[model samples]
Target: MTNSIKPRLLLEIIAVGILAFAGVLTKTAANVAFPAMMAAFHINLGTVQWVTSAYMLTATLVIPMSAYLQRSFTSRALFLSASLFFTVGTGLIVGAPSLALVLVGRVLQGVGNGIAIPLMFNIILMAVPRSQRGMMMGVGTLITATAGAIGPTYGGLLVDRWGWRMIFIALLPLLLGSLVLGLVTIYGERRPARQPFAFLDYGLLALGLLLILLAQNGLGEAAPLVSLAEYGLGIICLFLFAYRSTHTATPVLNLAIFKIAAFTWLALTYFTTFMVFFKYVFRPTQ
Candidate 1:
């Protein structure tokens, strides 16, 4: 690459990496801050957990729809929207008076996060050359992995010395830098022609995912029978979604990826890694 192009590409990668790191940090930090949040909000463990679980559900729900969204929207537009949603969510959480508002804030942040993660990957693929793609991906992984590794420790220190809100507050400068750099560097992708969006398919997929997350959360908190019923309903909806993907012209999620053996193995590996990490992180400190 030319010297001029190299600097520009570097800046773009840096911008995307920073945002990804911040998003991951936000999620992991909240995990550590749960006890403090519960105490301050005057809520029980079951209720306080909605703060994190709701965000996870919202983010997960938004991801499948991203393929269509990226097709219909400009990269700049998507980045700006993501930044706005995240900023407003952070502001709300920082100033929220009640648990409800905090949950709302978390959902908005989740939406922003959902949009931002895919955009980060897409940007690297679009802007970086094929020769450099692998290197850039490694950088992306490093940023996210480092953030995930350190978030709880950082959050714990802040929570102990200051408060939970400080976590969000401390993140503001990095978030703002990301927004500014994104606005400056993320340009040139023209919007694609809008495709017909299948509302019913999307609704079914979203509802299915939502119920699954809710049921997962409810396992110990809700009665066993109620949890079982919710889990059953979620499974039914998911099966319907899988069936719809086969029949529909433009399914929100392309289930065909599952046909690849490597993809399935990769997914299983991710799940196993997450479970191990979660157990390690949340195990009793003693």
Candidate 2:
């Protein structure tokens, strides 16, 4: 909320970055332990895949709600809640006996990450002036995404040394530190107002997004017709959500922002590079 760099604001951003790091870190960290988890839980590969799939799907479904969440809650409250979710989630996985509990923990962590990632960008956009936003985002992105690059290796080392549970245990201190720092640094919002949540819009968006992703995940597994039908329905739901956003007084998400060419372009670049490239493009199989 300042034109110039402020210590308090810097600290707040740091707190947000920590949440991002933990979220991304946990995401990839869990990957390296799938085999171990399978053995521990006596599950098959498809079932074990749900460990990551569930977390990712939960995160994806929760992401669209970020706009609604930020509007409804304070920055501090959001940050604190995010940190707490992750910390609690970590604790669950650290001692979880069944695959079900581990999935529950991952989903909780996903919720925290979904809330935290967008909240960081929201802060930079609202608090930092346009002149400084790019630099701030660069710093924020680097800090947040760094954990992803190191996560597998970090997890491998921990799993090698102390077993899969150590991966979660290792994160406990950082998550706790982020929790305390967020409480001290983030103050809900600069100014606050109450607005009713747009449930129908959220429902449409969440359903559409979930269907689309599920279709993708079901590729090569389900009948071709089923996947196509799911994908088609997802598109229809999204179209209705967009139409409602334009027609209604208060849609959960402001789809109108895509009208801005620069923003839309940047969004597409991010989508293709992060969401599509590794997963779809350049894959050995079609």
lDDT tens digits, residues 72-107, model 1? 998878888888888889999999999999999999
Q: Using lDDT as the measure, which candidate wins?
A: 1
In model 1, what lDDT does residue 186 have? 76
lDDT of 2 by residue, 1-286 (tens): 4468788888888888888888888677777887787788998766777777777778877787787778778898888788878778888988898999999999998888888899888898888878899999898789766877787778889887888899889778887777777778788545656688778887888889878877876788858788899999999999999999899988777889999999999998988777653353212210
Candidate 1 contains a number of clashing pairs equal to 0
Runs of candidate 2 exceeding 4 Å displacement:
1-3, 129-131, 188-191, 276-286
| lDDT of candidates 1 onward, in order | 0.81, 0.81
The superposed Cα distance between candidate 1 and the true structure at residue 250, in angstroms, equals 1.1
Q: Name model 1 segments beyond 4 Å from true.
A: 2-5, 282-286
**Which candidate ranks first by TM-score, i.e. highest?**
1
Candidate 1, residue 75: lDDT = 80
- Name the 10 consecutive residues with the lowest summed lDDT in model 2: 277-286
TM-score of 1: 0.93
